[model samples]
Target: MEGEEGTQNAHLILARKLFLLTHPDVQDIEKVRLREEVFDAVKSDDMAPLYETLAADKIIEMDQSILDSMRAKIGDEIRKLDEKIADAEENLGESEVREAHLAKSLFYIRIGDKDKALEQLKVTESKTVAVGQKMDLVFYTLQIGFFYMDFDLISKSIDKAKNLFEEGGDWERKNRLKVYEGLYCMSTRNFDKAASLFLDSISTFTTYDLFPYDTFVFYTVLTSIISLDRVSLKQKVVDAPEILTVIGKIPCLSEFLNSLYDCQYKSFFSAFAGLTEQIKFDRYLHPHFRYYMREVRTVVYSQFLESYKSVTIDAMAKAFGVTIEFIDLELSRFISAGKLHCKIDKVAGVLETNRPDAKNALYQSTIKQGDFLLNRIQKLSRVIDL
Candidate 1:
């Protein structure tokens, strides 16, 4: 019992020790060796001997004063990891160094220390240079943009990641970037824009059949729809199997559709009206979903709008393969944005066009843009280098 107790005390002592010092040489390589030494000693039952060599009877009975000193030392060691690019650069050889920097950077960010967190990220990027890991660099850069909510920088990073993804970027990372873009729009209360981005993301994977049954894509779609058209999303629940897959992963989301999408339909019709109004009032359209509307309008025309004549909240949701609540949230956003000029008649469970003129303009613009893109694609295809 005495030997076990002694070993346990030695383990604690070593665990609490500040093995990494902030000094240039010490931080660069000495600290790395010291950390390994401490880890190995404790695991191999060799720490007790080291404890005796460092200070006789120190582990057996440490007083308050000793404990206080240990706390201060530990605090000081941690400080070396805080916002220090030099320390990060020096510790490049260690695998755990970046993680340590991440923890320290998060601590600074949580406390509203923006500059400090950025400084740490710069250090992290520099260290990854010699390591030749572009993915780590991209992750750190993207992380900085995310925490700072810097969309311009985030977009730039996405552009850089396009090539990287071809080389080695995983699907999860690529999808995560889309989710981040969706989140950025959502933060601005541009629910239509957010929903469009989310839908485009879903279409990218789904159309290609690249990543079927991807829960993140499903969840993001559900989340974006909930933000813009919860009613339609609730209705879609009955039709789309993907919704069920997501609910299986996140059971709590099922609560959003409790009333069979009562809230979603009302919100959806209202948003649908808002969307048309927005097209006229707010000329800046949602970049992602703009194509979808154009495609549907070009393919169906007045007949397509006619198809939606009996489009109850549930029926519209079924057409889209999303939740009724998600549809409602989206429709609500369109109504708010003045993009969809449809009003919900709760008494009859139907949608009425709010402004026929705005709808005509929306239809015209979408058709023009689609034609423009198609022409651009064709012209590019005819390129012959002679």
Candidate 2:
């Protein structure tokens, strides 16, 4: 019993620390006071009212049992807040009423009523409040953005947050907003844009000692590997010591990088397969699985093609552990995209790699160079009246 009690106490202590870390004051005195109250309740194990308060504050990480309990108790909480709102409206200004609405929105979100929460947010936005209150609203909107899976709304909330941070000269929050924006770009398969955003955010995050350093580095390397060519990746990511250090610490990522650099397609796939589900299901990466797979396959095919002038489709399919039809389709895509300079013979079941006609290309290049020289000389002569 003593050991169990000790474990429970440890859990509560950790929870309190997490709560404090996550719930910043944002210059709102009421919020700071409420956070203190929540901490006190946790310390004292006075949980009944604490649960409702946490729910209304959107601070509780809910389980089904907790959700049911909150549902049963939410109406009373809402009623009490509504009464308080009425009293505030009668005696105070719009700011207090806005706070009440924000509180009510948290309860609505806790109960899975997004529509009501959104309505409350609209009301909150319409109210003329202090900068602190407005910043709090931006935080709330970002929460709603994630809950709703609405990218556009998330982008708008980020913009609001960025504006607030800019006015306050909060460089950390501004950089954090860039990280969020980069993640949004990644989810939409804008790899180049996402890579650029992540790279820009890395220095800011690192310099400020931000908590998302691992995440930023991971995505920076991943996006660069996927989106950039080998030469660009070498220059942009692989050569960067800070990013390389992080990659070295993560074994799977390190292996992936090696495989990519070495053109070991099979090893690269193996490393990718060993990645965590969280990495695989990342909001920006999940949708691009098909495209990424094709890209990897193309890399594998290019390497395979370098060893031979021609190869049987069946042989290629078997080597790659895929069906002939799959290989055929992928090859066609590579050919059409000009990624693989090759021709496929359907009847012969062969892919014939084409070597560039260097003589013809050089002849054409020389002709263009001669024509350019003649044109320039003619222009120079005219200028000199020669």
User: Who wins the TM-score comparison?
Assistant: 2
lDDT of 1 by residue, 221-316 (tens): 434443433345544443355555555453333433332243343333344444443232221222334543443222222222343544677666
Q: List TM-scores for all candidates, in order.
A: 0.39, 0.58
Once fitted onto the true fold, the runs of candidate 2 whose alpha carbons sit more than 4 angstroms away are 1-69, 90-98, 128-136, 155-169, 206-216, 248-251, 262-266, 276-284, 299-333, 336-339, 344-386
RMSD of 2: 13.4
Which residue pairs does candidate 2 place in steric collision? 187-284
State the weakest 10-residue window (summed lDDT) of model 2: 1-10
User: Taking the tens digit of each residue's C-alpha lDDT, what string does model 2 give over 137-163?
Assistant: 665555555544578888888777777
Clashes of 2: 1
How much lDDT does candidate 1 score? 0.48
Candidate 2 lDDT (Cα, 0 to 1): 0.65
Model 1: worst 10 consecutive residues (lDDT sum): 1-10
* TM-score quality measure for candidate 1: 0.39
